[model samples]
Target: MRRFRPYLRGEGLILTGGMTALIAATIMKLLEPWPLKFVVDSVLRVEQPTDVATVIGLCAGALIAITALRAVFQFLATTVFSMVGGRVLTRVRSDLFAHVQRLSADFHEKSRAGDITLRLVGDVGMLKDTAVTATLPLLGNVLVLTGMIGIMLWLDWRLALVALVPLPLLWLATRRVTTRIGQASRAQRKREGAIAATAGEALAGMRAIQALGLEGAVSRMFRGANDRSLTDGIRAARLSAALERMVDAMVGIATAAILWFGAHAVISGRLTPGELLVFLTYLKNTFRPVREYAKYSGRLAKAAAAGDRVFDLLDQVPTIRDRPGATEAPAFRGQITFHDVHFAYDGGGAVLAGLDLTIPAGQRVAVTGPSGIGKSTLLTLLLRLRDPSGGRVVIDGTDIASVTLASLRRQISFVAQEPLLFSAPIAENIALGAGRDVTRAEIEDAARLADAHDFIAALPMGYDTVVAERGANFSAGQRQRLAIARAALRHAPLLMMDEPTAGLDSASEEAVARAIDALSADRTTLLVTHNLALAARMDRIIVLHDGRLAEDGSHAALLAKGGRYAALWRLQQGGRVRDAATG
Candidate 1:
């Protein structure tokens, strides 16, 4: 409810109108029985047969009028409540998605995508159901019950007292069942999320699963989670059924006691038969809502469980958010510095520790290291994908953390080994991150620079050809080339390339290397690679080992000194300096 408070700010008018309509509907419901009472007392039990026809006609007309008004009021009330509930649901789901997008990368890494989707879709859907079927109805029922109880007491206080004797027991039983159902429903929702996650993961990795011959393993995992969800669902349902039965028994006890007392009062001439009948009818009408509440208790419990999960996710403060007083960054000169920077992922050993380095404006620098030696971590730090646990990363004299993330990242261009292209047209993919008004000429020029123009032109639709997810329709080399074209399109002052040619064949490697050289001109470029030949071509190469800087110099200078960088170059080239030269 608190989570929904923000979205309900302007809904007061709609809420008030709905309540008014519900009141009208309840009044009509109470009046509908009166025509029958009139017919019973004044028409059927009358002493004179004369004018009886007129009495019956008047009662019939009253019944018709009450039924029509009730229909109209009930319709208005349900419509208003449903419309408001729907709007609230939309706002809740939209906010949930936007918040998830803003959550830090580490949070995403630790969570399952499918489970997140469940919260966004399924959990919010449950809240919507609650608003319509439970919340709105409960509000109406409470008002109806209050009004009906008042009328019954006014009609005959003794009959009213007898009818309510079972109420305390009903309340106690409902409370006990509701508590257990809530717990069970929570477990049910959790297991449902697990089932969804398992199925999603398996389907997403279907290709790998088939290639590795692990279909049975994935199916069994999905089946186990599905079975748990079913069991929990059934348990919740059973508890809800029992609650309904308890409510039914209580209703029966109240009705029986009221009937026995009302009959005696009528025989004693203290109450008329028509009045007793009206009391009985009002009792049933009031308990009608109680029975409905008992029936919907299970659904409300499930909704509560869903709301808990949604709020829990919303409460997670992002680890990477712009600080207060953070200012937008100006255009960069591309000089970068790492001043005693330290970082480590949760529960993992240090990835970088007390690291110090600097890249001058417009310098072409290459970073080389063995696997898991923080080459990628350096790029992540520069992009602010994750903040350092200590120290600062500065660009053009501006501490990145002191500036807004969008402005800071806008100055840098990155191309990874695997590109994440959307399922959009090739030209759109090339123009991605290049701003909305990028010209066709600019896209073509970038494609040419990345050696992708010819291949793109060869396709039937050329730039209009739609790319599949992850650019699966294209070869790895083509995807890498398209990524390079995207970077070229950005033309940012700072560029980062990570293993751009590592997985490609010799021909593709040569093509991508040319694009890198063309895109790197006059940019403060940082290249991370295992290719010794590529390192030799850079203006300078920095080698990292055991979370510390091992060596930093030009390739020829480091080779001449025979230091760590030279040893790495020799090992990769197998002592063949000629092979390195050719590469």
Candidate 2:
């Protein structure tokens, strides 16, 4: 409730209007039975009543007018409440999405993308729907119930007390059934999230699944989650039905009691037949809220579960955020220093342990290491995608942590190994690296520098050509070149590439290597790769082993030392020789 206050604050006026309409509708409903009571007493029971036909007509007209007014007010309340709820939820969804994007990469790494997506789309949507169908109507019914109860007591206190005898029993049954229903609803939501996660994972890796013929395995996984969700859903439905039926039985018992006792009162001349009819009518109306509650209990419980999921995600403070008093960083000179850096992932051994290294301004260096030896971790630290657990990473002698993240990251351009591309125009994808505005000519120049212009121009839409999902429409070399073009457009002082040519063919690797040379000119560059050919071209090569630097020297010098770098070079050469012989 407190978390939702900010979203509701702006809709106060609209919300008040809705409440006012609901109250007015409740008043109209309370007046509805009175006209029938007048017809029963003033027209039907009166001996030689004056203007009998006129009285009957007036009572009929009043009944119609009361119902029509109630309808109008009810419609206004429903519409206004729906509009306010929609607006509130829209803001919530927008904030949730932005918050998810702002969270650190570590949170994303540990969390399932599909579950996050479910909270964003499915859970929020459920809240919005339940607000309209269950929550708002329930509030309106509660108002009606309160008004009817007051009227019932005013008409005849004895009959009112008799009619409410089953109230405690109804309350007990509701409390028990609603608890079970809520539990079932929460379980159902969890199972549904699992189903979404499984389906999303399968679809995202459909190519791999098809290649490996794991369709049956994936189907079984999805079916397991789906079956669990169905079981929970059916349990909640059954409990909700039981509660509704219980309320119906209670309402029947109360009605029977009201009829028996009120008839005795009418026989004893303690109450008029008309007043007794009004009491019975109010008794029936008063229990309507309880009946509605029983009917919508499952939906309301599901909504509560959804709200819990949303608020749980929103409660997670971002681990990475701008520090207090952090200032924007100046343009970097590109001299980088890692001072005794120590880093580790959660529940894992150190990936980099007290490792010290430095690269002078405008130097080109390659870092090579065995798999899982923290080669890529170096770049992630420099980019502040994850900060070091101990020591500092300094750029131009300033601690990176002292500066705003946006300002610090803007000075570095990184090309990931896989070359991530979103669904956008080819030019837009290139321009994203700029992080600011860039002209068409600049984009084209960057493309040409990366050796991507010829291929991009050959496309039907040229620069305007839209990239398919993850740039799957392009070949490995084309994607790599485009990624290089994006980095080139940034024109940052420090450039980093992670295994950029790892999966490319010989022709594509050569083309991409040339593009890398052009892009890295006069910049501080750090290349992480296993390709010794690319490393040999760098000014220096550093080999990491067991999370510490084992060797660092020029390619020829490292080869002469016959150390870790030399051993890795020989291993790659042997693999190449074997491949060539097979060919």
- What's the lDDT for residue 129 in model 2? 97
lDDT of 1 by residue, 181-281 (tens): 88989998999888888877887788999999999988899888888888888998898898788777777888888888999998998788888888889
Quantify all predictions' global Cα lDDT against the true fold.
0.88, 0.92
TM-score between model 1 and native: 0.92
| Count of clashes in candidate 2 | 0
What's the CA RMSD of model 1 in angstroms?
Answer: 2.9
lDDT winner: 2
Candidate 2 lDDT, 1-583, residue by residue in tens: 6788999977888888899999999899889989888888887774847888898899889999999999999999999988988899999999999999888989999888899999999999999999899998889888888888787778778888898878878888899999999999999999888888888899899999999999999999999999999999999999999888888888888889989999999999988888899988888877888899999999999999999999999888878888898899988999999999999998999999989999999999999988999999999999888889999999999999889998988899999999989999999999999998999999999999999999999999999999999898899999999999999999899999999999988889999999999998899999999999998888989999888999999999999999888888899999989988997
Per-residue lDDT for 294 in model 1? 77
Candidate maximizing TM-score: 2
